[model samples]
Target: MAARLPLDLDPPVRQLRALLLGVDDRELIAPTPCPGWSVATLLDHLMSLAEAFTEAARRGADAGGDRPPRPPSAAHLSPHWRSRLPVRLEELATAWHAPVAWRGLARAGGITMPAPEMGVVAANELVMHGWDLARATGQDFAVDPRVLAALVPFLSAAPAEGTPGFLGPRVPIDPEEDEWPRALGLAGRDPAWRPPRSHDVPTVRRGSREQPPAARRA
Candidate 1:
C-alpha cells in the first residue's frame, strides 16, 4: 500500500506549495480578502505562523508540552514577512517536519490532540488561505479533504466571549459534518467568495453584525 500521508500540515504543505507554484510572485504582494494585508503581507503571515508553529511543536514534542507562543505580533513581523518571508517559511516547515523521537512525545503532554497540533493549524492556513490566495489572484484552487477534516474541530473551538473579532456568528453545526466551512459560511467566507480578474478583490457583506473590516493576517 502507498504510504499514508499525515492528515495534517506536514504533508499538506505540498498542496499549498502546488497551489502557489504557477501564480506570479508579484501577486503574493497584492491585497487579499483580508483588509489590511496585501497579498505579500498575508503570505508572510501564513508562512510565519507555519514556521512559528513548527518551532512550538518541536518544543512541545521535545518537552512533551503544550503549544509554543504565537508568532511575534505583525508589527514586529512586517519587515521580515515582506522581505524574507518565503525563505523563513520554507526553513521552518523543513525543520519542524524533520524526523525526531519528539513526534510522539508531543502528544504525551495533552497540550494538543494526538498527532501534532501544529499540523492541524498549518493545514487550516494552507487549505483556507490557499483558496483565499487563489480567489484573490484569479488562480484556480481546491481544498484537500484531509485539510478540511482537520478544520472541523478548530473552528468549533470557541474563545472567551467578548473576544473582539474572534467571536463570529454562532452558526449551527450539523454534528454530522465539519464545522469550519459552515462557520466560514456564517462568517461570509464560504461559496460567496469570488476572485477578481485583475486587481479588485471581492468585499464581504455583513449579515448580522456589521461586517467588520477584513482581519489582518497575524
Candidate 2:
C-alpha cells in the first residue's frame, strides 16, 4: 500500500503569515467575515488555536484538558500581537512535523479526536480564517489544492446546514462549481458575497509548486 501523505501545515501557514505581514494596526478594528469578530479578534483566535493545536501535537489526548475556552476578543490581543501571532503559528506548523504528532488521539478546542483528524481541522482553521482576514482587509488571498484536498473529505461529510458556532449555514452554489467555491460553501461562506470594498483579487499561488520570484520556500 502507498504511504499516506503527511498533512502539510506549512503551505497554509505560509499563506496566513504573508497575509499577517501586510495587516496594518489601523485595520485591526475592521470586521471579518466571522460575525462580530474584528481582524484583531480573529488574529487573537488564530494565535490561541495555533497554541491549542500545537499542544495537541505535543501532548496528544491530554492537550486541551477540560477548561472552557474563553471567547476570543481584541482585548486579549497583546500590544506585540503582530509579531507574536505569526511565531505561534510557525510553531504550530513545526510541531505537526514530528511523526508522533500524527499518531494516537489528540484534543483541541475542548474536543478530542484522532490526531490526524485534528491536524486537518487545524489546516481548515488556517485557510478559512486566512480568507476571513484577506477579505476583511481587502487583500488578495490564494490557496493550494493540496490544502483543500486534506479538508474535502471532512467537509463533504459535514452536515448540510453546517455546525453551529463552528460553521454557519451552507451557502448555495452551482452544481459544477470548482473545489475552491465548494470548500467555502461547505464551510458556510458565500462564494459570491463580497465586502463593500472587495474586488477581483489578483491571483497569488499558495502552493509549494512554482512560486512568485519573492516567495519563500515555506
Candidate 3:
C-alpha cells in the first residue's frame, strides 16, 4: 500500500484552474516562457497530463499504459477552452482527493511509481504550467509556497543535465532568491524570462558578414 498524498495538493490545483479561467481565446497563440510552445499548445499539454494523472489515480498502476499521442493543433481550444478545461481540472482534483487513489502504485506517462509520489508530480505539473500560462498572457502568477516546497525534493533529485523535455541548461540562481525563482531555475526555466518582442528579427550572420544578395532575396 502507498502512503497518503500530502494534504497541500489542492492549492496548486486551484491555482491552475484560476489561470485556465483567465485565458482568453485571443491569447491562445501567444508565446510562453516554455520554448516554442504557445499558450494553446501548453494548455493542450496540461489537459492531456490532467487526464493521464486522473486515470492513474482512478485505476492505480495499470493506468496510462499505451497513452495516445497528443494532437498537434490547438483544436481543443475551440468551443471555448474556459468551458471545457475547468471541468476537467475539477474532475482531476476530485479523483486525486479520494483516499483510495493514494493507497497503491499508479502509472502516469507510462512510468509506474508510488501513488503518493505521482500525486506530487501531478501537483508540480499544474503549478508549472499555470505559471507558464499566466506569464504568457500577462496575468499575475504567484506560486503557492506549499506547492514549491513539495517539489523541492523532486528538483533536488533531478540531474544537473540531460533531462528530457527541458528547454535549456539549468540556470544558476542565488540561494537567497524565493523558492519560486529557485524552482523555475532548477526546472531549466528563467523566472525572469519574457517573450521576445514582435519586432525582433532573428538574424543569422556568418562571420559577421551580411547575407549575399541572392541568399537574401531567396
Candidate 4:
C-alpha cells in the first residue's frame, strides 16, 4: 500500500502568521459567517486550539500519556483563550520541529484520530477560520493552493448533510481540483453569484462611461 500522508506543520504555521497581519481592533468584534461567532469569538476559539495542539505535541511525546486539561465553562471561552494564543503558538512550533519519537495514535468520537493529529487539526482550523476572518474584515485573501489541496479531502470526508454546527452546506467538491468554487460552494456561497433582487446586485460598468452611482437616497 502507498504510505499514508505525514502531517505538515510549516504551511499551516506560516498561514496563521500571515492571517495576523493588520487585523484591526474593531474588526475582531465584528460578526462572521460562522453563526453566532464574531471575529473576536473566532480568534478566541483559535487561541484555544493553539494551546490544545501545543499541549498535545508536548504530552504525546512523553511516556504515560498526559493529556492537557480544558476549561470547564463557556464564560472563560473568549477572554482566557485569546489572551494566551500567541505564547502557546510559539511554544508548540518550537517543540514540533525538534527531534522526537512519534508514538501517539488512537481513535475517538467516531473519528479515527491519532494523538499526534495536532498538525492536521491545526491546519484545518487555520485554513477555514483564516478565510472567515478574511471575509469578515473585507480584506484581500487567498488560500494557498498547497493548503487547500491538502485540506479539501480531509473536509470532504465528513457528512454532506448540514447540521447545527458551522460546517455549512455540503456543496459537491471534486477532491482533486484546485479551484475555489468547490470550497465556496461548500460554504453556502456560489462562485458566480448574482443577488436575486435587482436592488441587491452590483451594477457593471463598461468602457470609459462610469455607471451611475447607486442610489444614495432611501
Candidate 5:
C-alpha cells in the first residue's frame, strides 16, 4: 500500500532540529542518555544516520550501497555542524517523501531491510533520541500522541533491554499507561530519568515568592 511507502517525518525531524539548535558549545560536552556518548558525539551520530538513511531512501546509483556505514565519532563532526546538521535532517525527511523510496530493499548502517521498516526505524531514532537529548540538556519535550501510538506495537514487541549500542534494559512502568511513558519503557529508557539535581534547573524568585524553573520546550 502507498501508506507503507512513507510516514510524514517532518514533525519529529523538526522537533529533533529544535533540540539540536538549542545546544550550546558548553552543553556539547555534556553526556547523553546513550552510554558513553556526549552531546557532540550524539549529534555526530545523527548526522551520520541522516546521511545514511537519505541514501537508503534514494536506493539509486548515488546511494552508497557499497560503502560501509561510518562509525559515529565526535571527531567526525564538522566545524559547521550548527548549520549542516539541520539541513541534513531536512534532507532525511525529504528523501523519504518519495513513494519510490520505499519500493524495494534499502540499506543503512550496513544492514539491508525492506524500506518501510527502515522508514519506521528513522522515526524511532528521531523521537527516542530527541527525548535523550532533551533529558540530558534539561529541556522540555513531548511527542505527539499519535506518533507514540504509531510506535506502540513496534516498541511493545521489542525487548526490555538491549546490548551496548542498542537500547539498554527497559525501565519498569505500569503496563497500562500513557503511550509516551510506555514507549519509553519499551525502548529501555527509564520514564523517571532526570538530569543531576545538583541545581541543574534553577529557581526563580519574585518580590515575595520563589518558583522552581521548569524545562522549556516549544
Candidate 6:
C-alpha cells in the first residue's frame, strides 16, 4: 500500500476551506453530489470527521479501543461553522504533519488500522467532497495533480458498483481525458454530471399525451 504523505493532504485541506468559506446562506440548502446531503449537512459531516481523525492522531494506535463520535447532523449547523470548520481543518492537517502519526496503527470509529491508510481515506473524503460542493454551487474545483495521483490507488480500490453510500454505477471514461475526470470516473461519479436545470425537465409530447389509436381500437 502506498503511504500517505502529510504534504499530499495540504492542498485539499486548503481548497476545501476556501470552498466552505465562499458558501453563502442561500447555497447552504443546495443539494450536493452526496445523495441525501445538502451543503450544510456535508459541512457538518466534514467537521465531525476532522474532529474524530484529529483525536485519533492524538490517541495513536495504543490508546485502547474507543470509537470516534458519531458524525453531526444538518441540524448541528451554527453561525460559527464557517469560522469553526476552517480551524478544525487546520488542526487535522497539523496533527497529521507529525511523522509519528503516520507510523504504527491508528484508531478511528473503534477500528484500528495502519495510520497511513487512514490518512489516505481522510484525503479521499476531503477531495471528493470538495468536488461535490464546487459542482453543486457552480464554482471551479481543481485538485492539485500531486494530490490526485496520491488518491488514484484508493479510488481504484473503491467498492464495486451498487455498493451502499457510494455514487451510482461507475461511469467509464476515456484514458485521454484530464486527470480529474478520470479520477472522478473511477470514484463512481460522472465527470459530466451537471446540476439539473429547471428548463431541462422532461415534457410530454403533444400527441403522445392521448392514448394511441391502436390502443383505443384494442
lDDT of each: 0.52, 0.84, 0.76, 0.55, 0.78, 0.76
lDDT of 4 at 55: 55
1 versus 3: better lDDT goes to: 3
RMSD to the hidden true structure, all candidates:
9.5, 6.8, 9.9, 7.4, 5.0, 10.1
For candidate 2, write residues 49-157 as lDDT tens digits.
9899999999999998888677898999888887888899999998998888899999987899999899999899999999998887766777888888878788888
- List clash counts for every candidate, in order: 3, 0, 0, 0, 2, 0
TM-score of each: 0.56, 0.86, 0.82, 0.63, 0.84, 0.80
Whole-model alpha-carbon lDDT for candidate 1:
0.52
- Which candidate, 1 or 4, has the higher TM-score? 4
Candidate 5 local lDDT, 1-218, one digit each (tens): 54554477888898888887678798787888787788888888888888888888887333666666676788888989889989999999999889888777888876777877777777888899899888777676889666676687877776665645656787888978877998888788887876554556574321224355443421
Model 4, range 81-181, lDDT digits (tens) per residue?
Answer: 43466566666566455434124642222233465454555566666776676666554456767767666666666556644343667766566754666
lDDT of 2 at 110: 84
* lDDT-sorted candidate list, best first: 2, 5, 3, 6, 4, 1
Tens-digit lDDT track for model 6 on 84-132? 8999989988888777888788876666888888788778778888898
- Using TM-score as the measure, the top candidate is 2
Q: What is the lDDT of residue 134 in candidate 6?
A: 83
Q: Which ten residues in a row have the lowest lDDT in candidate 4?
A: 101-110
Q: Any idea what lDDT model 5 has?
A: 0.78
TM-score for predicted model 5 compared with the true structure: 0.84
Model 4 segments more than 4 A misplaced: 1-5, 61-84, 98-103, 106-112, 115-118, 162-166, 172-178, 184-218
lDDT at 173, model 6:
95
lDDT of 1 by residue, 100-183 (tens): 512554432224554455556555656666666666665555565656666766655644231232223444445565454574
Cα lDDT of candidate 3 equals: 0.76
Ranking by TM-score: 2, 5, 3, 6, 4, 1
